[model samples]
Target: MLENPAPPPRTSPATLDPSAAGAGVPCRAHPERTRIGNRPARRRRAARIGVPTDSPELNWLRQSLRACDLLASVHSISPSDRALVAFAIEWAPYGGADTEDLFIKFGAQRNRFLHLLQAAMIPRPSDLGHLRNLKTTLCNDLLRAWNDTPPHNEKQCRRL
Candidate 1:
């Protein structure tokens, strides 16, 4: 006759009720393992600025911002902050500023130009005079930049 095997080891009360023993409850799906005590990890904080993925400047800015953590400073203003605000404005959509054949063409280029005009990076007073001055200066600068370049010909249009 075959010998009877030793009886399987019995579970103690403490082992069965892990919570009562201060080990916490076992996971419902995984009864053999004790529940984790610590809180779950948090998601990483994201940058407030939004920029297009295709922009090389945006990639460089993100890397630089991550390395420095410039946002940590309370009062100091950094170049990264300026760039962030600029790009955020650049990517934002603008309503009809001009019409083509009674239709408005809204695209990245038009938005960028609108952003350069409307972004609040420049300092100003509450008075209307200051605002007007700021607008004039910005418009003049834009005119100068655009006028510096010669007009594109049919060949340039074809190449584009």
Candidate 2:
């Protein structure tokens, strides 16, 4: 057999540098101005007041008051009335213990203050065993009255 013809000369591909190949073209990317691989630092917020960390009932009431739409109604009432209602929210499940003080502070007779509280939609738990339930119902009523939402049927409420 005839010897194989001499191998053809090998041709090597040339590599091009990106910077040299695109010298006249401008890049629109502004990588330095935007965040990359690093998250923005979170600002710390102040702690909320009026609820003990250990008490679930107080915590729920505080959260409900913040989220409820009845806030407008609270603002529409007189300032003293508003203060009493706020105090009641903080003293829920135990408003009876503070009745005398509530009376003095509001500068109203017991019956008058009671009527005011009822009218203001202030909540008070009627039974020790169902304190949480009562608070939840109060929150639900507030939500329904102004927000048109149903009561929370969460497991925490059922546990009460």
Local error of candidate 1 at residue 79 (angstroms): 10
Q: Judged by lDDT against the true structure, how good is candidate 1?
A: 0.37
Taking all chains together, each candidate's TM-score versus the true structure is 0.19, 0.36
| Weakest lDDT window of 10 consecutive positions for candidate 2 | 38-47
Off by over 4 Å in 2: 1-54, 67-70, 73-78, 122-160
Candidate 1, residue 35: CA error in Å?
A: 54
lDDT of each: 0.37, 0.46
Q: How many steric clashes does model 1 contain? A: 0
For candidate 2, list the clashing residue pairs, or say none. none
lDDT of 1 by residue, 111-144 (tens): 3543443343333343255334533343333323
lDDT (C-alpha) at residue 119 in model 1: 42
Candidate 2, 135: how far from true, in Å? Answer: 12
